[model samples]
Target: MFKGLCRLTSVAALVCSTFSTALGAESGKQVYTGTLGKTPIVLEVNADGGGDVGGRYFYQKYRKDLMLSGKKVGQTLVLDEVPLRGDQDAPHPTIRLQPKPDGWSGEWRSPEGKVLKVDLQQANIAPAPAATVPFLTTLRDQSPYEYLRLQGLDLKKGKAETFMGYSLQWWIEPKSETTLFEVVSGYTAAERQRINQQLMGRLWQEVAGKFDCEASAGETFYAQTVEPLWMGPSTISVSIATEYSCGGAYTDENDMPLNLDVKTGKTLTLEDVLWLGQGKPLHYEREYNDATPSSESYDAYSDYRTKTLAPWLVQQLSALYPDEMKTTTEREDGCIYGDEQPWTYPSWYFTKSGIKLVPSFPHISSMCRDTAFSVLPYNLIQQHPGSAALQLP
Candidate 1:
């Protein structure tokens, strides 16, 4: 696999430009299947009239987007690579191709003067196909998909196992150690498919994100552990902890919990399970990749999470689990998970008995966040449940 997405050089004149190739913009774009020398690629060139040419392409093997731009020079279309944000050293390649009876044929030349033969033929791509689109095609389908496919995403299914009476299949990106679990049995085929889509889409992001990081900084050291927290009848949940270092001064670590409603294939949020806000529950992130949440909406959500829910959650947990809530120097310099400060906006997942919440802490107290001690009983979650019609076990 390619180490990273190529970037633009210091030249500002040859920079990437903005153009929408969204859901219904296929008319404006033309897809091509060809090769830049021996390597295969799927190129998208602008089809809207005039000599001005632009679009993007991905290596058939890499499945990552590399932008292109330029205009027609007589019979030949001359295009320059539009470098994205990445490493300092970019080849800044250029392509010169002339339209032939079948398609287009040209030469790909790099800044270093290395040249290779370029050949291309239009590809039939559908944003919305009648049948199940191949995973490779969906990599750049540009459809209103349930999940956003990132550049350099290579999804591979690994390990088949059983957890809590649920048949599990793991989709893994070995390089980054990114793992996503798919429920293989239990529900109808349609329901299982919907769930698999969600899992695979997320897997794409994790893998692509790693490739992106490596491309920008070169050879990132990434490791992830997917902990299955729940595989109950009503909910499927997992917690992912990632630690990465991409030529940085220090490694960075973060954790996220994915909780999906087993029935509807919807991601369940903290507010969805337990909310004490007088106003409506907050949307922490977009439900789908295509959504554009305004800054104002995000600000309101931040306020609600910090001001409203954080304190209320602490109060509730404190009242319920007073012993666990008590802070002592014994635990990671007194960085307790039940501490009101850290528990304010925790990443949580569902469990058979209760809700397992892990606190967020400063780098100095990261160890405290590792141990999940603040668990809220299912009884409370059922009391102030949000809009989702969930059956609490």
Candidate 2:
């Protein structure tokens, strides 16, 4: 994605230069970052032939991207804002500014009849580039099910930008029921379209909600999906990773794993694939609801983590990376060498050869970068006590 942005920057620069030289016009694209009133903003101006201007202006406080269009007269440029969703009755906002060698200084008129002064410095940044290639593509009518497609969204305000991105490279199934589609009935073309729209709509709303809140708080939020791992004949797993900053000293990173059963179109929990001791069956919904983390279901997870999963993981890690464990223990005092708090359960995904575990940042060590990952070979897991329940041959 960075490479694509770099390419766009170069192309835009070339086009601007060509217009300036050939047409003898003030034609170029410049990005400015600063604040409008109390809110941060990112404004882009693209001036073309005959002083025709158009670009995008973003409001960080509201996660709104307003279209800019106007004309340059003499040494000053005047641009008006078009709302993201057009409403005919809303008052149109306008900006009048003069270009300086270092940046732009302007006056802004709000839709609510308020006027404010704006001073901005040229932001040495690249615009969020569009996704040109699909992560995976399905031919028309080639398979019984449509391939999972990748999508990207960007919201920029001043120097801050939030990107919601997904990758479909791990979608290798030729034809099978997906968790997103199983809730709806029928597989006709129209039904498939409806299912796809609903699935994508939900994802968009989730990201947009976060973006809107963070914008007002003077922060940025980004979420993306990692490459999926196929666990077995019926299971597919992927991790949704998120980074957020609410004008804090540091950003927070989190990971949520989704282990879906392709056959049943439901998520597979620990109880589904492994026995959880003698008791009534336990089932966990795939979706993670922030509002319900304090509920009974979470308590059940906490118990399972402390008593069963953590111990088993320690044994496996000891056998896999003994030297690293020994060194870590020797470095810290009062930190029980091998017994680290296992609150952040490792998100696991299965491959043909083994099961890969990805623990969120700060789970294993405070300084670990990104996420700590390890793979337990299929043979090794099969040797464990409850391997028979996994249904792997």
Candidate 3:
């Protein structure tokens, strides 16, 4: 069920107005912190039954902005956005919470309501996420796309830098001299290699070009630290601090794109690169055995619709001919590969299923969409007079 996706799923800012020491702690190894702001594009999920299911993604060039935070360590965050019908606008709740020694307890209320409630603690506070290299600039600034495969990042120098008026440290300082560092001494050779190889990069050229970089610092560095304090079985405490510019591209609410041309047929752009992701894989083992008690089955093909079918078909094609298919990872590689996934429907499936046209990623409604699409392409080619049946193991 969609709820299972929620189960699989699942920060702060300095400010102009500093809070009293009681509300804000700035000294003595204050709990590490992080903040994610101005996530240019808004993600609207329908929350049908699982992750990204039955959701219509409207890539608003510029409309609403997203931000959140929690106090203390080991807290849980539940963000719910229910799309209302027929002029009825649903209210969304932005909750801040931390675990109390007594039990799970935190205050929650809608932005439009005064009816606040204190609920029992169901989970612990989640730690901040890892700080990684910004994708676009990394790709553009790095070596020839052909040689830039994903690999471990070596922290040559580690230190801190004050960015955007905030005094922040660099967890994995780049190999440059101007950076800072505090090497934790206590590990074997294997441990040292593991620490040295901790690297993260993003694919952002498309998004960055669509929206300009907000700063002229040439390049800014950030840091992150994670501590394993259980918020839930998989949850932990995370503290992060990074530099972000307030002057980058902003899309007007009306400027968002309702459609996406993901397949090879359409023109490739930085926007596509920004949110590109491999179609979700239906992990048979996880879905059937490891999923939560209330989890739904992972079926690629059952009921069929173009929306439900396209991504599934593409995923199958990807599995069948992985080296040739376009994936977010490969796209980030920036190499000249063969045809990309066309935004348009391949001819064979449409005729058999008797459907016309399909929406892009966020518009998908069900697993069936992916499943139907997966088999349809191969099925079409197989039916061609002398063609042999395509095999998928």
Candidate 3 residues 182-267, lDDT tens each?
A: 11333334432222222112112212222222212133222222221111111111111122333323211111111112111122
Worst 10 residues of 2 by lDDT: 139-148
Model 3 TM-score, 2 decimals: 0.18
Candidate rank order under lDDT: 1, 2, 3
| Worst 10-residue lDDT window, candidate 1 | 2-11
* TM-score of each model, paired residue for residue: 0.70, 0.44, 0.18
- TM-score of predicted model 2? 0.44
Candidate 2 local distance difference test against the native: 0.47
In order of TM-score, best first, we have 1, 2, 3
Give the winner by TM-score: 1 or 2.
1
Off by over 4 Å in 1: 1-33, 42-59, 62-107, 110-113, 119-124, 130-157, 173-178, 320-341, 362-364
lDDT score of residue 171 within candidate 2? 16
Residues 59-156 of candidate 2 have per-residue lDDT tens digits of 64443556778899888888887654447457788988887776778888987879988776655322222321111111101110111011112222
Task: Write model 1 residue lDDT over 174-208, tens digit each, in one string.
Answer: 54567878788977787786666666656655775
lDDT of 3 at 150: 15
Which ranges in model 2 have alpha carbons more than 4 Å from their true place?
1-202, 209-213, 221-225, 280-294, 331-337, 361-373, 379-393
